[model samples]
Target: MSVQRGGLGRVTHIIGEGLEGRIANRHLALFGLGFVGLFFVLPILLLIPESLNLGSTTPFESYRRVANGIYVDAFVRSFLYGFVTTVVTLALAYMLSYFLAFSTERVRTAMILIIVPLWIAYIVRYFGILLFLSPAGPLADLTGFETDLLFTTPAVIIGLANVYLPFAVLPIYNSLNAIDEELVNASRVLGAGKWRTITKVIFPLSLPGLVAAGLIVFILAAGSFLGPAVLGGPNQTMIANVIAQAFLDNFNIQFASALAIVYTVLLVGLLLVFNTLFDLQEVLGNI
Candidate 1:
């Protein structure tokens, strides 16, 4: 029995020693980087060659087409909708999160309600919104007001904002909740009004989560294919819809790739601008 115990100890030591230096924090990055390289970077790089007509005199023709007319409008609409949706979502989420953090006696109940929608698929929720907003649907049937909201720009923005609101709420709530109550007490005791305290103290401290939420919602909303396709009109068409139509409907792979590359560049450029304005490295570090 003693010999068997000794043998087990030696085996455990050997296993521990083998794992100690072979696996590390940096090694985890290797695995992640490998996956991103194979799946993300490789695929995006391949789009460049696929987008070009290698031997043709007008190899750059697809890019030229992408720069003009409806395609340009699609790109503009995508960013515009994304920006508007982010703004609306943040305002609503911040107000809700502030209430949940400070005023609520049932934070768990409120959070569960907020999170429940996220479990429902995006398509299902958007379709439900479609039915609710349709002229013959509930708003008209119950209220006697025939609404023409479906398949419009406002409808698309509302759908995107609703779909992404839970995402914004969770982060902002965390930031607000993590704040020390004493700071708030001090602000109140120092003669600051409720509105002034929120503006001066609470809002500034919550910027980290606000920025994180904005980044997430903007990226998701901008690249959305289903929201605009399901809820928007021709005028509200976005970049993702254009890309999908080119690839799936028209089977113009080169043109689709050009659209994709341009969209990606624009999105990244916006993120760079956001980071410049917010100093994301500094802001997100707190969160």
Candidate 2:
């Protein structure tokens, strides 16, 4: 009886502790969460039946089809390209945003330039890149060097990074711009040099934005359809391409369903690992 009472006390204590200023406006997020829940997540859940053949002796058949060597390679290629694109996009966006935040007076003009591309359709922007990278395009006209960059891995990554640059920049700039000027002045007064001040104070304060940008870019890049379709070759095909092929061209609903399920699972697993490593809630809480 004492052990039962002790356990019950512990459970109550845990719940009480959790309720004490621990949940940061989580209720407000329910609308956006509801959209994912009702639209994206629910639809994905509904695909489970289509992904299996329960009437047959082998219900796991579609999943088995996904284990093929080519399909495996596509999954690996998709994630690898996603990671590389996120890194490159973040680096470029951070530098650009830092300049916009601190270095430049023409922030309005620069922001206009950065934002203008987002107004353009993705296919149009990708097609423009296609022209620029092609052997017959402006690059070849100037350099007189016809290159195979148009239909390769590097081209695809470049396209993904460029396409997603604005997403990263906006979030990071908001974070950077929100920082108090007094804090920066205080750091300088405390004998922290320019680089030291930026690295130690500015960057840490900006992490919430950086983390938000990373998640947005990573998800978009991983599931990209147009970038790889326009810029990559057969060797560079990603999972999205295969899913498109299965669903659109081949009309293989079961195969497409299986691919979608696997991709969703893998993406969620990766995000979970990322959250664990970064302690994202803690990082954002500081903001």
Specify the highest-TM-score model's number. Answer: 1
Model 1 CA deviation exceeding 4 Å by range: 1-25
**CA lDDT, every prediction?**
0.93, 0.94
Steric clashes per prediction = 0, 0
The segments of candidate 2 whose C-alpha lies over 4 angstroms from its true place after superposition are 1-38, 285-287
- Cα lDDT tens digits for candidate 1, 63-98: 999989888888888999999999999999999999
What number of backbone clashes does candidate 2 have, counting pairs of residues 3 or more apart or in separate chains?
Answer: 0
Give residue 118's lDDT in candidate 1 (0 to 100).
Answer: 90
TM-score per candidate: 0.91, 0.86
TM-score of 2: 0.86
